[model samples]
Target: MRLAFSLFVAGFVTLAAPVAAQSPDPVAPVKEVMDVTVTNWSDSVDEWKGIFEGDRLNRLYTKELVELYKKASEKAAKIFESEEPVDPFDYDVVTNSQDGCPLQDVKIALAGEKDGVSDVAVSFRLWACEDNADTKNLVSEVHFDVVQEDGKAVIRDIHHVADGERDSVIEELKAIIAQEE
Candidate 1:
């Protein structure tokens, strides 16, 4: 019995060792996507400094987010034209603060993802050239929610961090859209 048990344990380890060695890191693909998006976006933002604030702000978000904002902006414009009582959407949702914005003086770090109950949180970081009242040089850890959309991985929401507080881009969009009626 002892001999039989010892052989089974040895065989299990042998099989498991090779499988573990061959398996690629599950988080590697997530990191790659985050790196490309975050790094490229940072480069673009820095390159376009001193341009119109609107243009700069538009450049910092994903295409889906940009489109969503554009729609809301159109609605808000109509409201303003008609002299509405309340603003349809808070424009600060993207930047996470009323007046503050994201400035990427350096490339953002693409950290690994944390598995959540409903979605995955891909970690990232941004930095400033100098620390100020709003941001540290290293800023803080930011998280983007990755969801499988149409069989491909796309960021559905951003947990935006500005002025040291976290906010959600998708939640803000929902709130703005809900106010339409």
Candidate 2:
């Protein structure tokens, strides 16, 4: 009887391991997006232009946000081809800045969750490359609204606060798409 009980316990433990490992992490999707952004920080401007477009966009963002980005990109392309070209997306959406140093000390945490959605807070410091005495250690925080879709987490929206201004990436994309129409 003792031998049979031991065997049953061992089998249960072995079977439970895979289930625990397969559990979804709420912070994973946000971290994936941030990892790619920081890794390609020093890439050329032309290369960075597609960072939030194409396959990456579809994979990282929610369906609604992806559609908005597509529309915004289309409008920006039209403006670029006109006789007087102007870049609609003048700033980097991810960092919320036109210029910045390489990101460091990146931290991601789950701020809250409600109704099956999670808010992931990401904070990072920009390491200043120059030896300027006046340049402060710049720190920024961006919050991602994440939701599960088809068993995987996707970013539904992004919230940014910079220079005393608050904005949503979704609304900004919509504004860009409506600019010339």
Candidate 3:
């Protein structure tokens, strides 16, 4: 009876050992690398305009960010508001161009969000963001890459390549960014 019991115990140990080894811990890959992507803002200017025109800037920006955008937009519009009647939603009028820049895709990615700061990556479509001969030193588009600070999104830098038609807009934005004292 003792010899039979020993044999059974050994067999059970071998089977259970193999089963435990086959199971994988689900949390093994918990430490993952994340990448935040920042993309050019002007590439998809028209597309973004469409989204915001149908919706509200508040849906897309924080309250502070929206306020800044509003101030800049209003300032620029005031500068050229007399150029023609603009509906604000009408890019044809906003740009005052019979034909405007083609659609270019701009995207931002969040690699990781931790503590108070977020890691991001950004880029834009240079081909579509370029200036035309008619702009005459105006900024057709401005792309901003920012790190949010103190409950506000602060632009780390700006990328501008436009003609005269867009200069007022660029200057207005620079003023707004600078005013975040």
Candidate 4:
């Protein structure tokens, strides 16, 4: 469909042969992002908050989460700052404070786990903004994939799914694969 649309546009431009090569470039191609409307995002809010702000967040990771975080952290440390978000590929949590806009809603859909692999769907209202402050609904579908490690109930492989954010929780993976008990 995209190819067909581009061909049609080209045909029209050629048939209408503009008089000036200097004519301001025709309307620029608009980049479109998704608009998400999320509700009941509060449940994850606490979880997220704890993960971000909690000093001992690692302690709650049913064992598996700890490993995942460690692996992810290790991979991330090789590339980004420790304080930066674990999911560095555009991973951000929205705030409730914003202009007169719709409430910040993030609808998270979690898939059951089996054989150490689980899927989570994050449906939310991504508020469009000039900066991170203008918060407005702009995205609708967000998904995450998690993998469990041996003898652990936590997730080690954290994949956002939307973007190729394949990062292992550094410390966790190291603990598992590292030598010398």
Candidate 5:
């Protein structure tokens, strides 16, 4: 009985070792952001506010991106205090639009790694909650640059394409900050 129990324990340890030693998925942060975006599509104000102001900002985004976002937010706040208040980001940065529907056929994959950063490709079709919505015009794609930070994967930048126009979140944020200054 003692020998049998010892063998069982050893087998359990061996089986668990591989699972415990697996590396973190580089695409996890991208998937998480997409999931949150889709799930909170109806509550854009609070959801985005939480992502920008709460701990999720630091947990999911790189330091440089976070700094840029903070600067933009500060500038927006200052403008809000002025006589003519204007929203710096009129559209949702993630979707690159002011309107979005529930996501369907969502796909997230780690495309490749370059210079220690991983490229994550995300594509989805907008489900308008209709039985016969045109799916062709509702497709969207975004790419995320992720890097290891503190031994965890975090998003460094986001690239969005819409209507044959290319946009980078980092570049947009910098442009917004520069335009105001």
Candidate 6:
């Protein structure tokens, strides 16, 4: 009887161990569009701040934007390389148009997520709290249009909040490129 009980206990432990190992954890990886949008602001606030302070634009910018910036810089270079004097403002790259992340030391909060649109809105607040939050002191709100390109959610455009109006930085760049052509 003792030998039979030991065999049964060993078999039960082996069976339960595999089941426990296969269970998924409660934590989640940031894969979806919404998750990427939030993580970019929350996990990268300091990095964004650095960019605002004249640091290089990293992976946060979309490929389209980066290419446009390159083209704009090339155009400026060619113009400046000529004997004609160039106005600094007239021959500047689009990326240099804005200085860093619009908000400073603010907590990024998800405002909403829309289905089928792949657009996410995020609000930058002064600080975060579990309860009794204040809404009047919001730093700024920004809209992100994300697209899955090459298995990654890239920021296509940023609709920055300015003076109660929203402006798309990408759209502005496109217009500038168009005018130059």
Q: Identify the candidate with maximal TM-score.
A: 2
Clashing pairs in 2: none
RMSD of each: 9.9, 4.1, 13.6, 18.7, 4.3, 9.8
Q: How would you order the candidates by TM-score, starting with the best?
A: 2, 5, 6, 1, 4, 3
lDDT of 1 by residue, 30-105 (tens): 3554444443345344442221135533443345765665565556667567543333444332233333233443
lDDT (tens digit, per residue) of candidate 4 on 5-124: 999999999989876544211111000001211222333333323232253334223455544555555556555556553442223322222232333454555555566445555554
Model 3 TM-score (2 dp)? 0.33
- CA deviation > 4 Å runs, candidate 5: 1-22, 42-50, 82-88, 127-137, 163-165
Per-candidate Cα lDDT values, in order, are: 0.47, 0.76, 0.38, 0.40, 0.77, 0.46
Please, what is the TM-score per model? 0.41, 0.78, 0.33, 0.35, 0.75, 0.45
At residue 39, candidate 2 shows an lDDT of: 70
Model 1 whole-model lDDT (C-alpha atoms): 0.47
lDDT of 3 by residue, 101-181 (tens): 442444345445455434343333333535564342333443333444444444332333355232333344447445432
What ranges in model 6 sit over 4 Å off? 1-58, 79-105, 115-117, 122-138
Residue pairs clashing in model 1 are: none
For model 3, state the Cα shift of residue 63 in Å: 0.5
Residue 102, model 1: Cα distance from true site in angstroms: 8.7
Given candidate 5, what's the lDDT at residue 137? 48
User: Which stretch of 10 consecutive residues in model 3 shows the poorest summed lDDT?
Assistant: 29-38
Q: Indicate whether candidate 3 or candidate 4 has the larger lDDT.
A: 4
**Per-residue lDDT value at 175 in model 4:** 54
Residue range with the least summed lDDT across 10 consecutive positions in model 5: 42-51
Q: Compute the lDDT for candidate 2.
A: 0.76
Q: What local lDDT does model 6 show for residue 51?
A: 23
- Model 1: residues with Cα > 4 Å off, grouped in runs: 1-74, 80-127, 131-138, 161-166
**Deviation (Å) of 133 in candidate 1:** 9.6
